[model samples]
Target: MSCSSSGNEAFMPDDIKEKIHNHPCYSEGAHHHYARIHVAVAPACNIQCNYCNRKYDCSNESRPGVTSERLSPEEAAKKVLLVGGEVQRMSVLGIAGPGDALANPGKTFETFGLVRQFAPDLKLCLSTNGLELATYIDEMVEHNIDHITVTINSVDESGEIGSQIYPWIFYNNKRIYGKEAAQILLERQLEGMKKCVEKGILIKANSVLIPGINDKHLPEVSKKLKEIGVFLHNIMPILSEPEFGTRFALDGVPSATDQQQMEVQEACGMDMKLMQHCRQCRADAVGLIGEDRGAEFTKDTFAGLSFDELQIKYDLEARQAAQAKIEEFRFFLDQANERVRKEKEELSSDGHTILVAVTTAGEGMINQHFGSVREFLIYEAGDKGIRFIHHRKVEAEYCAGPDGTNPLQPILDRLKDIKLILTAKIGGCPQGDLAAAGIVADQSYAYQPIEASVLKATRKYFNLPEEMEVN
Candidate 1:
């Protein structure tokens, strides 16, 4: 879904609109065209959440708090220049970590300073637990860090639910635990968030939906976030796998289902603008939200590169021109998508919705082949319009050398609920398997804008006219 459809754009000020115009995580439309990079410069956290398990040199996992490598402020600055030069669409530089950005203020601010000096056009963002956020508001404003994300799970005030999620917190030079710790943390979070909002920084609150723990309580959290003038709220599913070693995972706290997440998002969305496209990116994540390219520019890749060489590559005018072209394409794409949304509303029948999956490598287009797809961006399409629901990650590419196992079966199983699959191309054998499984696979809309294509496909499947009157 695009940001304008949220119904918040009508009331949003011009400055806020400009701030999120090109920010991938902030704007749903920009995510396809723009990219962000997070540097793991801070490796220290103040609070302990039940769902967190920080790990280093961990390239296998894609969730938050996992980084393959940590860098100093100088190294991070150099890497930013290199990536910005290579990936011209890269626009934001965030310092979300294997730890809290606020916990290591020195490193976080230093990195922000260097980036500001060398690549002033790149927007700076920081994500934290909000423990030390109030303390660094001045520094944040000084560094021109206009975007901030705070993970706030509960707002129960009494600290009942918060205590269950957080076992302990190290505050005021002491380890505080239980209800008291939760209360303190919540107080600080609120105070800091309010201060940041007052400073005109766009705040996006992230809440992890733990099934039985705080699922029902999230609506209240969302309401409170909206009351504080938060720009967006993201309800993310808890990733509690046994191998990651999070406290909740070890205790068998099942992760939130996609349905459960959607339900909560529906409830919270009534009070706050919801962000449904988060990829739960890693600390050192690079490139687009759906794809990571950190390994392509590791420390060793630019070992001997000097500051002057990297700076020369960071061409501001060239980046601006490329971004302008992207904006021009999006302007036309948005007009096309708006027509689809209107057509969907007029072609309503019994409020029925069908799930559709698209194979994409970012840039908001169905550009990936079926066999090479590592992930499928799932969308719910119907008379209500197309909305992104989930990101399903497959274990391995279908074309990967087989170990005598039917790769097609796993792909089928994963997409069993899907009614249609939209991709760039599909093999004849796999296409047959998908058709036999009652799933329709289509490649006619290859590399097309995802939402318009999905809605058009949905209309075609339901026997509705592909085009509607432009009234």
Candidate 2:
């Protein structure tokens, strides 16, 4: 199933060409130019690899399963958009997690769906432990995820070698250990790889060159993967550090030297296409290989920020004087409504125009946490005055874990073409997000009537003309 250079025209499929053309991890030719970003949306693992310690994020260390932050599906999608804009060369959005992506299927697929909806051209990639490979292959294909990487350390004739590499595996709702666990994992991984191959999914097999453990057996592993139709093989060197804290911490396992890695890669290259440029990136890695920009988007850098700080970041002065004058605000609302009514009449004479969104509790009061609000009261803002359009439903209370995945994407999608958003309060990240979409998020009035907030926003923020101008 391996496509040699000589037989490239004969065996390489169209899907394979398109997938590898822009994917840096699979194509040596594209690595130097095109960029990729991996969003750590999945944080739950189903298998335990002895060499992997997913606890810390070390910048100096380059390996899979290490990330500075874990974002929710919506959060991941937002970051993907932000990063794509920031890095115009980015062509792929991958879900290579701090944990197994398949184990956290809900978040993984949700992130994929949101990103695909927004970025249809962006290539989607996923890396997994292969425990739940078969279970999710159909779904992955359905989502158009063409690139998948499976870490297969050992496929020894006996399960002894694999047993040393992986301490245990969680399968069938239970934990299996020792040789039996190794056998099950290997069988499943191979079966899953074969399934992915049959589905026309480009498979990249990653084998850890764990010196004494699986280094010698890698040729056999590579041969099996090639025979099973793996498109590429990546042999990664294990980082054996006691401070990293894993089962292999004090095992005295010597790290594979540069000479050892090259030699092993050469031997495996004969059987299959060897990926020599594997940087062993972290789960939340961004930008080009070896050029990590994750620090710019970390939770500490962007999360837990107040709107005041955000206003200062954008250099927007506090509207303290305007806010204090309740009478002026109320007057603006009245004039805004009258102007809106006239505008709507003109718009309805022809067609319709703009939409506005507001976060509020029932009975028309501006209340509810920006992160917790599950519904938005949408309105059609025109010269006819702001009229209630409908209620837009979203995921309720998305504040989960340190990296909270809000239903912001879906909410934004629902309130499409919205000119402004009136809310009691909003975080700095979301405020910036709204601003990017040309939607103003005004948190100037809290516990105020919804109509007053909407009217004030229309006249002052949205630049809607007053009734006097209409006259």
Candidate 3:
């Protein structure tokens, strides 16, 4: 169904289409590419479009809907490994977030880092609304992630249909939008694509065809993108159905049917993938080519995994097996805990308790906040499933409770017999001071009060999900 936008120039000209099909990722969607796994990073989007019914998370699907579950980098890496192994050709690592990926740069980059380290040969790809792409080009380049997908609906901001789709966009909260803002955004996205091409990043576009809205504008989009060096355009058919709820509201406007979709594809020189396998999966969705889930995908089907599948009869047997391994070689940890308990028994005083400092910011800034803080050095001293040490800080900043003489010091001196110090906040100066004072600052706790320091410390903080944030 390949046609042309400019009165039929070269609908995805053979050379360009060959480039796309030759790409490591263009396979799964078509028969050429092997497999694709899209990670849901930032669940928050900047501009709102009409056709986007995807929940903040593509992983948050309803039935096969995985719109709710967002995995950490560690978990995602593990899942990728499992899926890649199962599918036998999961070469593309991608992120089709509910929002844009640039917003979740840390999570996206961290996850990418671990994945690259764990599985180096996999090809990485990311799709964004193109709002923040300009800010993250260097980062993507550093990570060697050149396969990019930018979803651009229309190039003409003044057009009636496009204006309706991009009615009011917000920039810096003031909302400098209308036809003007949409026009500006379109230009910025084009500029971003140019920069991407200059850097050797292959840009694939996803354009949602909403009948009268953007369907006619595909030609200009494809033409402009081609001039800007976009490798391919994937003109997507609008999947908004009334039954799918309020995701994409058409009001009285009907959607593009198979025939209309094909017609639009022919009009634009772009690859249109609405293959039967296109389940409109969640951002963090996972699955085999023709399978529903669990039997093939763990995303919507993780809970279905039972002990029987793991070859264990009961949960206790699995626990015992692991427990046996720990006891055989790592019982010394328990013995060490006992020793610390005995030492604490010697002091037994409330005023001599150690302080715990877990932070979201990194050590340097953490120290900037707390200064020369000292507390009991905590290590993996907790066997309660979470690692941490109870420590004391002698800084006015950390206590958020009190200031002066580091009141926690007396407690630390009392718990001189205590094993470790685990605080919710930590910085570099405090780390150095604590190190000298036999106080260890370990951050394994979830610090809700100050997120920056906490996230910086553990590199594991998810910028509070918007749905759960305080406005």
Positional deviation of residue 244's Cα in model 3 after best superposition, in angstroms: 2.6
Task: Using TM-score, rank the candidates from best to worst.
Answer: 1, 2, 3
**Residues 1-471, candidate 2, lDDT per residue (tens digit)?**
212221232246776666676577876435544678999989899999888888555665556778877798877876776666566567788888889889999999999998787666678999998989999988999999888989999887578998898888999999999899999998899889989988988888889898888889899998998799888888887777776676786777776755476568657866886675567888988987545888887665435544334333322122223223433544454453333322223433235446667776532357766777755665555433454443444533434323445445666665556788888888898889878877888887666666545655666653555332433
**What would the per-residue lDDT of candidate 1 be over residues 1-471, giving only the tens digit for each residue?**
232223345357889889998899998778888999999999999999999999999998899999999999999999999999999999999999889999999999999999999898999999999989899999999999999999999998899999999999999999999999999999999999999999999999999999998999999998899899998999999999999899999999987766787688777777777887798999999998888999898998666798889888988889999999998988878776774442223335577888899999876688999999988888778754666666777778999836999888777767878999999999898899889999999999999888899988887878887654454
Tell me which residue pairs clash in candidate 2. Answer: 340-383, 340-384, 340-385, 341-383, 341-384, 341-385, 342-383, 343-383, 344-383, 344-384
lDDT of 3 by residue, 316-340 (tens): 3443354355334323323322222
Model 1: which ten-residue window has the lowest total lDDT? Answer: 1-10
Those runs of model 3 whose alpha carbons end farther than 4 Å from true positions after fitting are: 1-33, 56-68, 157-160, 173-176, 247-250, 270-280, 288-471
Clashes of 1: 0
Query: For residue 459, what is the lDDT in candidate 1?
Result: 77
Model 1 sits at a Cα RMSD from the real structure of 2.2
lDDT for model 3, on a 0 to 1 scale?
A: 0.52
Q: What lDDT does each candidate get?
A: 0.87, 0.71, 0.52
Residue pairs with backbone atoms closer than 3 Å in model 1 (clashes): none
Name the top TM-score candidate.
1
Deviation of model 3 at 184, angstroms: 2.6
